[model samples]
Target chain A: MTTTRTPKPATAPKLDPKSRGQGWGHYPLFALAFVGLALFVLPLLGLVVRAPLTKLGALFTTPALLEALRLSLVVSLAAVTLSLILGLPCAWVLARYRFPGRGLVRALLTLPMVLPPVVAGVALLATFGRRGLFGPAIEWLGVDLAFSTTGAVLAATFVAAPFLILSCEAALENVDPRLEAAAATLGASRLRILWTVTLPTIRPSLLAGLSLCWARALGEFGATITFAGNFQGRTQTMPLAVYETLQSDHDGALLLSLILLAVSLTILIALRGELRR
Target chain B: MTLRADLHLTLGEFTLDLAFSAPEGEVLAVVGQNGAGKSTVLAAIAGLIPLQRGEIVLDGHLLERVATGIRLPPQARRVGVLFQGLALFEHLSALDNVAYGLRARGLDKRSARARAHTWLERFGIDELAQRRPRELSGGQAQRVALARALICEPQALLLDEPLVALDAQTRLEVREVLRETLGAFAGVSLLVTHELDDAVALADHLLVLDAGKLAQEGSPEQVIRAPATAHLRAMLSARRTGSTPDPGT
Candidate 1:
């Protein structure tokens, strides 16, 4: 095993021209970026400034607040789980297979994202509410979805699953099919290839998608209130509670808003590194 | 093992019709210029592409038959391929990459890793087993890919430009490694390359393809001495003018 061969010398590091210098022409773009940054931060700053910091402890201890927070956590987590279970396969189909009317299917799947939240609520009701399309069959099964916690979860999932689907599809699309082909040549079945190669390759994107879906579910308001009919300890999540307290208890509403903002910001920050990579 | 392939594939304006066979313990080199369907023939045999109207039988087993609508998947074909780019799993360590086929075939992880280590030792890459593909040099990666392809003891081996990515020194080293390995392998093997030196050095038989058809097929000495096609003649002339004569040539 002994040989006189020498390891090759390390190559010099490449210098990027773009990193060499900053030009004056970039100022306008920087300013525009700052403007976009301000657009997001200003409102958050306003919420923080108007928040009743002294009464935050008491506000947080209120029964309605605690119940809403708990409900929001449960419903959003359930929505995220449902989205991962359902959306991942849908994404794989959209990304890997070619079929007729694929464009139409993708557009329809993403429609809820741009549709008004209240309109989405109405649509859900028309499809699943009592006296609606499948309502009789569901009732025959002794299952009531509308105006229940299940309805709230369904509402959140309807709006948030699209984010997961789109992100996961993009990630799957970016995966090198050659790797899958290589795995197949090594005698791996289709499902095994997906489990060992495809899924691991797109793990970062899956995490990012999960975080986005959960955050969207956590902030769901109009749809849940309209379809689930905000009950005190069952269907009333954080956003619904904020709406209810907005008129009579402005400080309470502010506290709830602040809490939602903090939680969402924390999740986004946690996922930022993964998304960037 | 023996491999018999009669492939007829049509893509848009291009049509590829080819028929070839290789017996056990023999290396068949397929050479052609760009667009001569060299890679296509290998892919068709490997079950990566479907044949429009043909049959591929390996060791008396029908791997593909267009008339009967029978096409076994790549996994069921028991054909190993070393792709032109090697296509090593970039995220896995070299040992893991070599063990992938064994694991896929239901071997336990411990035994697979142990066998992969033995293969790595044979290839003189035992110390580099922990390195990922990106961390390995071109020659090192080629050895890992070779071990991965051969670990399954495939009935047929298809190598697509196996040494084209390496530098001259590394190419010579890898060619010697491949020559020794293929010499000892008892299954049918087909190598696709654009370099005449590769064919002359490693392959027992040569097939020259021109415009999607076979132009010449014979022993390397016969083909090189009396080239039939203009492309073959030009290649021979070019090789004659070159300074260093390949050892096999």
Candidate 2:
């Protein structure tokens, strides 16, 4: 029996990446994407274009601006540190363990991320204000968390911690359980494995979370004003200062907004690289 | 010294019940199709998974006794495992990966690194010590993982499909390295593989498993000459045909 094979093509058709999705179908998508991009870009451009550049020297010398910048840095750093200390265990448990209501617990922890900043301030006030839930106990300890710098820090932490928790939980979930098992077989304890294996493995994402948390804390205004009550050097951070100065000194407010915009843009760019890793 | 395990584990719809013993300095290779619970057996012995019932005794020390509710954690088991993926610490340098167990045991960084360097030399990859796991070739990474596993001097070593990640040529090279390195080790070793060549070449005893139960058990030659179950016969014929069976579950 003789078998004859059909003649094959002399050359296979190579896929040209440039030709991919290059049709009328992509126009609407491109148009919508550019529209969305413009929505975000326009306001930022407006901030830069409308700025009084001639007063830049004077803007840099404002005592209120300097004070607000210092408070914003200190408060955001403290909030991120607190989030790392408290949210890491929560994130680990959410990622590595299975139990009833685990999903509910995760959802509740993430709720703060979506919650309005003002509402978060209200929530904080309900829990820690002088006439609130833990008011008596807190007073007994000789501490006042309301209308103070600590209150601004608490408000920032309340709204910003969920970012760290969610990022860490995602990173933790992606970690291979087998690596931890291998570490265990090498006689490394749980704490040792977490220190030498888990954290290092998730360092990039952890840093991303920390930066996101810091950025959120730095931009906190509604929560800080509602809970901590703008007290200049004590409780008024950059965002709060921007809001206050906007009602009076418009130029100073734009300068403060630019400082915040610069910092947030830097954080977002850094976070993008971290997330890419 | 001997390592003995009688494990009965039930995970979801699958159940595993097996008992095996290997004297010190011997390699027992478990060959099975995917989902035969071969890896499950290793996990149970290594204390990564708990057995519903059964006791594991290594060198006359009870590692697990479900009846008495006494179970040692994996850290206390002193059972080294080279996972299927090799599970090398990707963030660490090859030297740091090998030194991890020593550092965990409270050795200072300088001493731990010095000892790890010696292990890297034993594996003939001392020059690659500063390179991360991702920078190494498949066979080179396998050497690093092997060095990391043995650096702690475990009482028993468990290897899960150690060669599955390698290409054909790399597999042969790694298999040769495993043969020479495992020869010098004094611990009872359990090698889990689906390849009959690996089982015959590296194992002192071969245990054929099918559907979470032991299908046959004997020396490599004995098992090959007399395939006890259909699974074993199929594996033998596949080997004869020079076709690799699917290793994925």
Candidate 3:
């Protein structure tokens, strides 16, 4: 036999009329949102529809394509690693310190994010290239950056590191400094507090920044080509290879573009919640 | 077991210039209006902020001396501060939050967590040790923060509006906990609060701060019997009449 029980009384208040979802006003808003979303979806659909699916296996087997894939992975990963190493301290300083020209310094640091990729490449070359500003100092250290794999990494980092730095700086700024102060009063040193409290508190934003930096570096084309001079098995990343193949082999270019698109879509899907926040 | 501070500093348009001493094993409640530099005194004693020209001595050790240019970092000052926001590390479990200071001082995780478990038990929150700060109720979080602060056995303890975030019932419960804790602790305890009731209830000595300076200091009964400044008079009058004090007055 089943036992009967009384339903609990509703304690929660009713929702306000204005906040109820899907009113007449939503139609126009959704229409515009759909149009904006279609702008992104249509191009991706075109890439998939025009991809060389019949020659997909053959494309995968191609040594040049594989080498470009490997190089892309290497360069982008290096750039991301370098970005984390340099950007974290830069972000902390920018967020915590107050000195003269702080706003200007922040603007200069994040300028690369909005600056044209080719201009960034040119700027990097002017600063690190032979006969450039730091050329003598770099040469004396027996390191050549231009037209090498390292130059490709540097170019990608120069354009992409700002993404990591900007997100992290905003995250660091939002963290209550009182938490760090509390940690200090608990006998934790500055470095210990950073590792334990500060970094853990900003972990989500740090991951988001890492993914953005890696994706930007992976898709970097103009900067790498301008500064590093794309060469097979040397500095030719996937985007550079795709660009060169488009001039001669359209199907090969489509396949390479498909690969990059797939990787970017995966990143966006994985970081959907974090990116939304 | 005494904290003597000569806080002399300027921030923007306001300046904090005061000298106060908190005796061991007793609560000294710092009562003030908003922007009266109540929290500044705690910050200076905790070594979180520098003093332009002052000295802070805790347990006869020089925490800060501007004349000699000797300023110990907060990590070395052996001062525990429970911030107004209760700044518990949200990323860690309650047990880990309580265990933070021990781990910071090089205790092994097992030992620190074991001791933290004991503290949680003492605070009657052993069951909620695995929960995060956000998951716990305000009162539970307060206990966790108190446990964290006291675990290090510091020379001084600072509580900045620790019960201001709690409801009336929870405030009374936590105030009882705080009274018991302060009675047991052998260090100097400075509580910055806005409520006269809490000050009179939990504190042995009452300090009235007005506009970044000390307005009065006496026992709670003494201060209650003789209100010093206009702010104090207004506060006591409001309490007697069961009304809120007027902000303009």
Best by DockQ: 1
Could you give candidate 2's per-residue lDDT for residues A141-222 as a string of tens digits? 9988999999998899888999999999999999998899889988888888899899999999899899889989998888
Instruction: Give the range where candidate 1 chain A is weakest over 10 consecutive residues by summed lDDT.
Output: A1-10
Q: Superposing every Cα of model 1 onto the true structure, what RMSD results? A: 3.4
What lDDT does candidate 1 reach at residue B1?
90
Worst 10 residues of 2 chain A by lDDT: A1-10
Which ranges of candidate 2 are over 4 A from the true structure?
Answer: A1-25, B243-249
lDDT of 1 at B215: 88
lDDT of 1 by residue, B61-100 (tens): 9999999999999999988898988888877999999999
> Alpha carbon lDDT of residue A60, candidate 2?
76
Q: Sort by lDDT, best first.
A: 1, 3, 2
Q: What ordering of candidates by DockQ runs from best to worst? A: 1, 2, 3
Best by TM-score: 2
Q: Which fraction of the native contacts appears in each prediction? A: 0.47, 0.58, 0.60
Per-candidate TM-score against the hidden true structure: 0.91, 0.93, 0.92
After superposition on all C-alphas, the RMSD of every candidate to the true structure, in Å, is 3.4, 5.6, 5.2
Better of 1 and 3 by TM-score: 3
